[model samples]
Target chain A: MDPSEVDVPPLKDLTIDNITDNVKLINSQCPDPRLKYLLERLVQHVHDFARETRLSHNEWLAAIQFLTAVGQICTDVRQEFILLSDILGLSLLVDSIDHPKPADSTEGTVLGPFHTHDAHSEPNGTQIAHDPDGEPCLVLCTIKDRSGKPVSDVKIDIWETDSKGKYDVQYEGREQPDQRAVMHSDEEGKFWFKAIVPVPYPIPHDGPVGKLLKLLKRHCYRPSHMHFMFEKEGFDHLITALYLRGDPYETSDAVFGVKESLLIDLGTVNAEQAKTYGVKEGTKTIVYDFVLVSEEDSRKLREAKAMAAMKHLGLRMKLYNGLPVPEID
Target chain B: MDPSEVDVPPLKDLTIDNITDNVKLINSQCPDPRLKYLLERLVQHVHDFARETRLSHNEWLAAIQFLTAVGQICTDVRQEFILLSDILGLSLLVDSIDHPKPADSTEGTVLGPFHTHDAHSEPNGTQIAHDPDGEPCLVLCTIKDRSGKPVSDVKIDIWETDSKGKYDVQYEGREQPDQRAVMHSDEEGKFWFKAIVPVPYPIPHDGPVGKLLKLLKRHCYRPSHMHFMFEKEGFDHLITALYLRGDPYETSDAVFGVKESLLIDLGTVNAEQAKTYGVKEGTKTIVYDFVLVSEEDSRKLREAKAMAAMKHLGLRMKLYNGLPVPEID
Candidate 1:
């Protein structure tokens, strides 16, 4: 815009001591209060981080280049930034903040970068393992609400890695989904599917995020788990994973995605139970119940949690002439 | 490496309340103590920002996509990240932190993204205006140290915008540089050059950074200024600019680079003075001195300033068992 068209306050001589305030003041004209608030808080925290760390010029440049590399490496299927966020535990943190559920409801976790929408819908008890690379496992699951009412017709997108510790998308020239499918729960809120036992595998570490992990002396592996994304009318969209017991990386999942409530045990199905599940005797099996919360309840819980956090942080709920400076002890 | 080969402390089921600590714990194994400290501080500040603002899932996704676009748009000639830093006031902040000058020394500012290494070396007093697009201006300057000692042979790379508020680099299919050149201070520490009067110009606004500025209700124009970068043996590399007083955007420079000390008035050179500067009569003139600090002095000052900031922020000087958590009041 032409300089004359800009509405600016009398700007103070920007110094280290006042630059943050100056930026906030200039940006106060944003029409969206929420955006203005977010920008203000963002500037405050980032500036504080720089000041507190006494970030050197070289270090700052390195960070810029690092982020650039992270961004440049992203492709249609690979999202290095999400991987970076996952390794830093931000993805899970955001999920937890957005999806706080009741004690009985299933907990949420990181939705890693491999999920795809092209999985073909299949019948219950149909085997999703097209590669035949891992031991067959029967997954028997029930979906219900907190009040123990069956929630039928919940569309569940299930995916997992093969015994080779890789998803179908990770392989070159992959044309169709393997060990992944879309299924629906019956009127009884029950669903059964056959899949290969997933194995622990390292996240894609050949890019900048991988280099960072190496520098931090960290492994990039995530624990073996089955990804489940549920979509149903009147229910909160659920993105979660069920981690298997005794996986090598179970306790040290690189993405910090493991939660005690989300961990389930793997068992061998007896002859009678195998017949009922429509699987062979002695097949590996997983049995777990997914307790979902209603969309209204989820939204209310999130708002309450957000308010409590704001209070804990001493933030105001309403806008004022200027935002109160967050105290830095 | 195998999971068993990876060294880990006892694992705890990660919860929102404990995730930050767990991430730090896992990353504490980093061999480099400084990197470890920086990472810890970065995680703390970012996580705090997310929590305090109750950053929504949509907001987080938006941020990720914005950053990715910023990175993807960078090229050999364009540094969108540095531009991002400039608009955010981080570029100037880093300059201030790294180059803390004394009262008598020339203050430093942003080394904006338009600088190039291909500037042709030109004789003193040579006119660099290849295009007859703007009014002529003569720049007369001397290089000196803090003690008023003349510092000779200082290589100065000078650049500025045309009256149209655009740099040569901004033009499509540009060839040789114009309105920019590399000159050197003589034995008397004096140098003069004839160039066009730079006009206030908007930073590139067709990209994501531009979109952000528009969102913040900010004008992307930086006040009229001439960029100067100096390099000399035994002296600090100085990157600074001289802003014209009374420019409409002087106080609201998009990059926050307008320091009080860096503002200079434009005057008309009389016939006699124009002859000395080898410019036509009534040419606009800018008279300013460049004061530089020695390499040793600059390093000492930066180190002391960093030490003090660390102390003020409650950071430790030496490595400890673990970094002290920064207080967030």
Candidate 2:
């Protein structure tokens, strides 16, 4: 507190004139041996990015607001951020990194924003086409091995909407289970079902994700398709989607779900041929089978293993995505 | 764009599953090879911090909104986020990193959130005491080198307010200049001023930063003090703030601007000493002169730099206490 002590200047002076100094300053906040190196790097890139863009203050504010709205739109039954990721191609990128296909194998496309995992398994020859208004068409298909030989006893779980493009869970006035089904293929590696070829339609668009799409001048429609899971022993079990042909939205499918290998021919059957399947003449039928790669050896974030490892790791668990998950310690 | 070529998957995939992954992903984006390593490291630490906290969606959303508001409040006239950095002790950390103070030297504190580049420079023998009710004071001190040699031609830039604890810009109706001084010390390396002892006061609140302080359960008062800048060649130029002795906010000052070396002694200068400075006899007065070290090179954001670079780097050109400007390429 002495006045005399103030007159003598000390060493270590800093001259700040530009943005690069920020990079250096952030570099100095190193603490924990593990994080020191990381902080130093991020500060540099963040500063560099900001400098390179000359990003205005208002633009930065808008970005923050957009992220805030993205968070506000997330809910128990809806994942608009995930939908955003799907539309922006980030989700597809992640799935792509984890799933690589060999030549002549099933090509994985974008999985639309909605997915349910508790589908009940049905035995072979079960009819899942509950919608009477749908085109009564008999679908015939065979599950084959990579070498093209038929593989019997393959499980084929299928689900699709009715001709009006309304899934069962979506429309309440429709008959119970009218637009959805779960069925398995026969032991002879064949599956037949009676359903209509679904038409492409727009996703629900009253939300922020929808608003963002409109802002980006993009559409909200996805090509109509059916979902399937086909699996057998010693072959890759595939969970895939098969799209119907002659849909105009196929080329510009908003969810980016259209893939060439998944498109099925929806040709009409004659009255004589349709009579064999107990349907009227010129009755158009729709059918498709899914192909999946065996993921038996893929890395899975299983709860059992995670719990066992949590003790020594000092891990803390939180509820996320409706699961008790251990975050990184 | 052809309808027939619709089913296509993207070429590459990326996911930020962990801090290490984030480091790797962000590092690859840095254009400058020199900065790549640093940015990679920073992203790792920031991501690790997020991971370590297991920050919730709501909390992250709050943080994003806070930052957005901070940015939004920042106009060309006022940058609230920078002020936030100053008040939160981050500005000091940045100063520490950029300056690299030697151990046992004076501890550097933050350049408090309000400094105007256009602070009117005062000449020797000019009185800035505009408030008639203030405690009259005479400040006198000599600038010296580390070896105690008196430094000549030392430039002293000083600024403070009247005893009522209000700055000119803060009081809209007063119509008086709370900031009124542009003076340097004499050839004896001595500087002196006569004014009322400034009183401690709360910083201007009512802004969003003030609201955030309330949310964090912190206060907004700053202990009374005067700002000083002293400089000469080859010595460390300093921008030091001195706190008033026995001020109420001393120990628990909100912004953590208290430094032992920066505290001034309130020794009573009798009537005889007061007469020498042209102040009324026995009138209360306080005095302290600050010394500064020589500055090295200063850095600035490159003008016409890439748009992205300007975003983050532009924050540096903001508050120049005292330093040489660096090249902008």
Candidate 3:
């Protein structure tokens, strides 16, 4: 589209007070209402931030250079941007906003940058732990609907760090997927596997995001948690994790992925009980049940949440609702 | 620093409502009071932006990817981040905040990304134009202190685009600088040069920032302007540009660099006038004067501005001022 043909009024002599308004005026030409609204609010917040902070040229340039370094460091195996977001708490915030769940439903958390598509598919009783340094554990879980009915054939993907707090992907080479597996629930909505207990780990801190954490004087350690993803034909796809109770970093998780409801206690089993669960006598065990929300139910809840969010944003929408679409040829 | 060593409170079950506060709490460990304040405010604004916009997971990922691309595209000679800042009005906003001027003093504008340190140094009245396709023009300029006294020996750097709106640096494999020169003011506080007439041109639009502009329906053209930088002992270094009057984009400069007081008009010169100015008969002419402020004066104004800006930000500082700094061993 030609600029001269834009419907925005001519803007002249933009000072600090007026520049934001002029910017909004020009960007208001965007044909998509949602994008236009997003840009308008984004500009307002950033401009207000600059004004309120009295951000100096040097400081602003420092931010620019920092962000540039963060982008430059990103590779296929490493996503420095997502790590940056995770550290900033934006990743969790977005997860909460996008996937609001019912009180009884299993809570969702950050899908973090480490999840990959290459995990081995296995039966429920298969052992996923291959690291000698890790202690063995048995995971027994049941998948159920909101009304507590069994939901069979649910695809459950589980991954975790070893005793030393490293995932399989973190290793440079010499690895079939260890400490991670994908399995299907039985007819009674049951799934069980043997793996290493997860340990608290620090996020990748050798990049620009790490530098920022150091400057902020914050640690980059996430509490020990097992990653889980659930998919079924009629249920809302779930991306979540289970945090271990009594972990030292639980209260101060770097990514803010910890939830009280998601916390579970690890139990030790006697020889007979361990044999029945199919793990060694010294192995740790956890028995947990996950509740899923149906697609129709998820849609209804999302519509309600979206309505509330729209009301919160109604003022800006109302202001632009009257804007005339420029006559375009 | 170890997470256990930090004196921040234990944050548990961080919901969307409390994630921002938790982030600030963690970041409050910053020893530097000013940096702590900046991070606190930055987190507040960004988190607020995300919440207020109801930013979705996919949208957030898009933003992350866009920023990564912008950072990845930057090189030693080209700064895509600065370009992004420029088009967003952030560069100009920083310039205005950092360099406040008295009413009689010349205003400062954004130092755009096209500037280079490799311009040829030349004597007064030397023709800097090398492009045969460009129209010849004589630029006469005088520099003075705010008191109207000639300020001799001022370092003046001037650069402008050719008639086609392309800078020398934009061309690949160019050996010599065209229409750009670095010169000093004479004892009489006078300097002159010959260059091609600048034309309104689109900013580099083949990059991520350009894609953003296109998405926002904003035209990427900046008004025709001549870039200038002036520096001398005891005076505030000035980075500014002159916008030609009546340019189609003058009112809507892409970088928001146009100010009413900085607008200039082009004049036609006769054969005798051209000969006196050491230019051809049909040459265009621009005669302008620049005023500079003393360093001491600049400091005073800056202090005043800083105080005002602080008052604008006083609420946040006040909230944090009483915050107890956690005792650390």
lDDT of 1 at A302: 80
Global CA lDDT computed for model 2 = 0.52
Candidate 2 residue A131 C-alpha distance from true site, Å: 35
lDDT of model 2, residue A10:
19
Q: What is the C-alpha lDDT profile of model 3 across A113-148, one tens digit per residue?
A: 787788899998898888888877788899999999
- All candidates in order of lDDT, best leading: 1, 3, 2
Cα lDDT of model 2 by residue, B48-127, tens digit: 44433333333443554555556455543355655565554445544443443444334456665455566566776667
**All candidates in order of DockQ, best leading:** 1, 3, 2
In model 2 chain A, the worst 10-residue window by lDDT is: A2-11
TM-score for the second chain in candidate 1?
0.93
Query: In model 3, how large is the Cα lDDT of residue A212?
Result: 87
- For each candidate, give the interface RMSD after superposing the true interface residues on Cα: 2.7, 11.6, 3.4
DockQ scores for all predicted structures: 0.54, 0.05, 0.53
Q: A1-329, model 1: which lDDT tens digit per residue?
A: 55567798766368778899988898888777778878888888888877776676788989999999999998767888888899898888888887887898999888988888889999998999866669999888999999999899999999988888888888889888888899999999999998987788999989999889888888888889999999998898899999988888888888888888888889888989876877789888888899999999998788777767777777657422222223331
Local accuracy by lDDT, each model: 0.84, 0.52, 0.82
Which residue runs of candidate 2 sit more than 4 Å off their true CA positions? Answer: A1-329, B1-13, B16-26, B29-34, B102-107, B162-164, B172-177, B289-291, B296-329
> How much is the lDDT of residue B290 in candidate 2?
44
Among all windows of ten consecutive residues in candidate 1 chain A, which has the lowest summed lDDT? A320-329
RMSD of 1: 3.6
Query: Can you tell me the CAPRI class of model 1?
Result: medium
TM-score of chain B of 3: 0.91
